[model samples]
Target: MRISRLRFPVLLAAVSASLTLHAEQTDLRVSPPGWWAGMASPKLQLMVHGPDIAGSTVSVNDSEFVIEQVNSLDSPNYLFIDIDIADISPGDYELTFTKQGKEIYKTIYTFRPRAANSAERQGFTQKDTIYLVTPDRFANGDESNDSVAGFVDKADRQAPGGRHGGDIQGMINHLDYIASTGFTQIWSMPLLENAMDDHSYHGYAITDYYRIDPRYGSNALYRQFSQQADEKGVGVIMDMVLNHIGSNHPWMKDKPAKDWIHHNGEFSATTHRRESLHDPHGVEADQKAFSDGWFVPSMPDLNQQNPYLTNYLIQNAIWWVEYANLSGIRVDTYSYSDKAFLSQWTARLTSEYPNLNIVGEEWTTNPVITAYWQEDSYRADGYDSSLPSVMDFPLQDTLVNALKDEETWGTGLVSLYNLLAGDFIYGDPYNLVIFGDNHDMSRIYTQLDESYALWDMAMTFLLTARGIPQIYYGTEILMANPDTDDHGVIRSDFPGGWKNDSIDAFAQQGLSPKQTKAYNRIKSLLSLRKEHPVVTQGKFTHFAPAEGIYVYFRTDEAGKGAMIILNKNEAENDVQLARFEPVLKEFSTASRWGNSNKISVKNASIEVAPKSASVWLLQ
Candidate 1:
């Protein structure tokens, strides 16, 4: 059970009276710089940090808001104040710290009113095509921030794992390129501060939750980027890491409690066996080893069971969503954190913004394991995850393997068919986020062994298939990491993102015929998808794979429909139109998508290009 806030004031009052005799003037800091009033959750925990500040008698100058409790942890430098801001209006209020009845220090905190209908802002949905980017490698619009004064890692384009100087300004500069590419949402890798000595370009090892990486840009710049992206009809999905923090995080040096981190100040790597969470016969030791272990020696796993720490993390997530006006969030390691804490965290955020969408990374290829974390899932343990969405790793793996393997028995496309048939395991199949490849995985072009035909098939399935689709940066131009799966090479610099690059993908200059075709194909499909609501909000029907061909259809309530056919043969195959008579009964003509040519249904057969995926509109 969690400790009660009612007992905190009495305990802290005694400590404050004793420390007042030796109190001295000092600096004070509060996290979540400020908050807004009238939030769904009336409670707000302010983490006050300063030298010997925990024992100070804390009080708010305003009478509208009540200071429910003041908590002092094992560390003398931190104080947790729980305040009820339910009935308070938006305004400035002074937080005064008195020691022995003498005023020691005072600081002003602001509570801004929320934007009109801010809670009703829509989150990313199936209609959105998300483009994932690694900001450091995407572009460098601000050279000044490439190597900040205090940053440990500087710009080094030659080093694949080193910072390449991409900043928020670079993303802002290319908003038009993104919007024109048919991507409605941009899910950039973590842009939070990662003040590490090396390999910080990925932004996974977060050192500061509130501060944006100076090398990337300031916090205000990121907020501005989100606003500008919104103006261009694009939403921003922030990537966040909740499982661990960089070793250099301030908490590592000055921990508030002994159990703030797992392993009790010692390093014990996680078993990486994510299955332990749902394993029926799983032993207690294995579950503990998996969740309590550190991700790496450099990244410390946070212990979420600590109520103070839990509240801090929950507040931090809400702070970002409110401050940046984010459309969605992509949690880095979803199952690695404490399961109960995840429920609380997601529930609080959802309660605040009912329409917000959050997609968690489970990284498991098993449908059962991945689906277990979604909200309203059926499980033996009866765990109700409040998560709205999860990465479709199971479908992703099946899609890739099916496209690569030959059509033999229950192999190849049959595997994909079976996987889609298993969609019943998910509470909401459309809420799952589907992607061909991400920053962590090999590029789709490379995954398909650089075959343009296979690439086209994969993209067609991704865009037309149910659920939200996320395309990695440079996928439009067929970026490949053929040599190795090195993080640096996979997240390569965009051709036109920098100043001196001869090839500018944005301008469509100096691109090969194959690259141009791939780019145009994606653009056309995305444009069509944006115009067709049936693809985003329609009922799905699929025919089992046969003779190296797979067929599927998406139809809406109004009778509008789309048919997609995937042929894996090297020679053009004649598809008998009679087999699809059930769906094509009312239509007389079939026209290929992205083309004006129409063929009469009287022909009884349609010629499908070899080694290609095709979509047709029946009218």
Candidate 2:
């Protein structure tokens, strides 16, 4: 049986006899400025940053939180304090810092009450349709924040890689549009401060972990956005980079320890080879090169092996979840960090929020490498990762390949079939996140040679497949980067996202006929998937590809079933329904999902249009 850590009654009795004290201080700063009273874990570590602050004695006015330990690191400007808050009540308390028996400074720390049922909050799951957006290019609702005085990057609508001024307010303004498109969750790229000199619009290199980028919006605005999105039935999934930080991050200027960052002396780029973790005969130096090497010259790789740094990252994650009431987190470059640290980090978060979902990005085309990082995976090396989910890059790669290849034996559509057949290696296939394309990859349309039919088929398969589906921004509007795979082009500004744009996708105005059809098709599929539980939660069964045709079925115990057929041939093909008899038994009628085209099961055959997807509801 699991144990409960918090016994509020016992804690309150132990701290009732303490005296309250207050003092004023200007130099000291605490990360996660304040915390709540009723956390699942009683312990909280505050990193105090200031000039020569390590020598000062630290004490809290309330006896509820006893300073268990005070750690002074190599840098005298930083001090780490471990406080026990298991029994504290929601109220204001003063934390005092003193030198030689004289009070130097004190900061007011408040313990707020947790939201009702916050611990049990449900996270994003397969039932959710995640809409991913690069906020800087989505829309601009608040022009006031476009060019904040202190920020280095400014809005430049003409530059594909420059900031386009899309802020949280813009996302807030289009909540109705997002909901109307049937997306239940929104996953924006990193919204935290990425105070780089150029190309900061991407938001990958974070300079500040605690504060939101002022150009994007204030921290309060971000919280408000999440709150409003929750009200609109949309959950917010934060994007976090644990492996590295922007070169300009404050920690780089004054590192608390010598090993706070890897490769502190000279620049060393990572090999980007993720297979070293499971490579039995792999060289120890190669593995270190992958984990310890910097992603680039500008991004400093964090040293999670340091116990203090590990705790800081873990606490920062928990703080955001509690402060913003987030539903989930999407970790960037998950496998590049220390494996042991990754396990502890995930375990801590899951312990606090049992239902919260955290999906890690393990960008590999091999299923074995990706599966090795998932929780409960049986690895021969005896390494256990507490990660709940991983990006389905293996399946993603096959999906695109299957669509682009020519129909042949042991090739083309068969590649996708083979990929799905390998699902047994995963701890939980349903928890994996599958997407057609993302900010880093070429657009789905471009990948499919700009074929609208192939694009439709791809969308249909992603939504009906087993794992959680993520749709990149502008995908529904047929966004394409046909000429190049450059990230700037792939993540170009969405139509009508900026003012004076020729096209507006949000309103469905100024779109071409083909674009309109693609948009409507996505909308129809998303709406249908939302209303049907079988697509999201039912058992997934698939058939082998024959003559460039692949078929799959999702069925629940109650007899509700969905049949999805993908026809890759240029000429129409008649699919023999007998091939799917295992799932079709006892069902007499079938109808196309988006239209009222009746299909007769008695005929024992269905005609599928060339290079098109046909989804039918079986009854």
Candidate 3:
């Protein structure tokens, strides 16, 4: 019924010419699209696609199997082979491709079965406290690999944006410290190879998609980190970048095609007008500027519109997920790529892992703009999406505004009040990733003007509020980077993490009094969060801010409730508790974390200290 695209006469002539050359024939180049260790069927369906190699047979070990599927058939490039297994086992086996009876190509495949009950089986949800860390700046466990081959930059702790010798072994050593801090998930910046001359330590500009940087560790070491993190009750979330590749990437040396990167020969900088993406009155020039512009000449924007490039990117992500056994993926600069390609990528990933979560970085200060990228939100333009979560930029913007302004008509705590009220704009409000400060901004301590009380109030609101809260590393020890937004200052070396480092915040050795108090206060919150299930999984309810005081509560059906009160005024203020009575339904008493006796909130007004926050457990 179908005409063959390949003419038999031409094909036979080419084969005859090849034989006349007297060249030795070799095996077909076949690769699986992607694979995972565990599956309900304990079987794999590989989508094998390559050049002309018809009548080729597939076999696992010595047994032969037939290809069950042939997709894109008129041209017919793909063949799907499925394998079945009864019980899960761990070992290596070879898969072979043969023609008639002789072998053409053979590749070894490994299946490592996990225990019947593995800690990695746990999935991410609305209930998690995520800690974001930059491994290069977090700590240095092995200094031997600081100066690596093929990388232009060397270890220079003094350089504001240089590598600092942090590796997989460093994180491994701190497993107990991370677990003890009450963080359920740890999301590290990309550890892939970025062999550029400047700012490569940040790990955003990727040189190689498949290999881990030797400076960080080997692929095997990364797998060990995942396994160890799982045992320590901490989930690992990988930072993935699909929009761009390092300029020095090998592909740039000899591109697969001229269309591999956008505006391949022409280099232009982006206008950084993110609003142009959704701007109704925006021009084509604006859209082009946002989409085609270079982030930096070193970070060449990849053209996802190219089918070959899209396949490569998608397969790369799937490979990392299966290889590292990653729990989740945090996509960087999510909106910069082709929208259609993004939908396809998201759909394919979710199709493979139904319940797995993928959070995107939609850095819009407006709720509507950010909400448009979420999974189920309706779009006027009718764009189908498979994205699940987005960073809460509206909340971050409001928190910054509220800290700088006094109580005005629509300002101060009112900014925060109105932001939370706009949760209706989002499809899944609880799935948003909320944070006070991250690697991009100044440290939380610096944002609060180095004021301990303001910092405490910020932490209280972040922890007690809804959505998944992410804490930046070193915030607990009051790391400060004032005046200069130098990333190295914001990402200061962890105290006592290295051998020669005299200052030890972990054991409180040689720390200032203020640093000691801040460390202890943060540690207390970490411990408290673990014991309170309501904080992890609960509905949020906020009360009006009056006289420099704001109140909120997190409650669940299990009768668990925690009250958070923040006072930002210079003087002490008494907050009326009657308004929150409805949430205190069956509770007869309330106890402060450090205090013993139950306090009465029925008809009393509580006096909160100036610029401080207090959390109470209602019984």
Q: Count the backbone clashes (under 3 Å) in each candidate.
A: 0, 0, 0
Q: Could you give candidate 3's per-residue lDDT for residues 17-129 as a string of tens digits?
A: 54453322332233442343454434345545444334467666322222343233222233445565434244444555566686545444445544453323444666678
How many clashes in candidate 2? 0
- TM-score per prediction, in order, is 0.95, 0.95, 0.85
Q: RMSD in Å for candidate 2, one decimal?
A: 4.9
* Model 2 alpha-carbon drift over 4 Å, by segment: 1-25
- Please give the TM-score that candidate 2 achieves against the real structure: 0.95
Sort order, lDDT high to low: 1, 2, 3
Model 1: per-residue lDDT, tens digit, 540-586? 78988999999988888687778899999889999988777777776
Indicate the worst ten consecutive residues by lDDT in candidate 2: 15-24
On lDDT, the leading prediction is 1
Distance from true location, Cα of 522 in model 2, Å:
0.4
Which lDDT tens digits does candidate 2 get at residues 457-571?
9999999999999999999999999888878888888888778889999999999999999989999999889888888888999999999999999989898888999999999
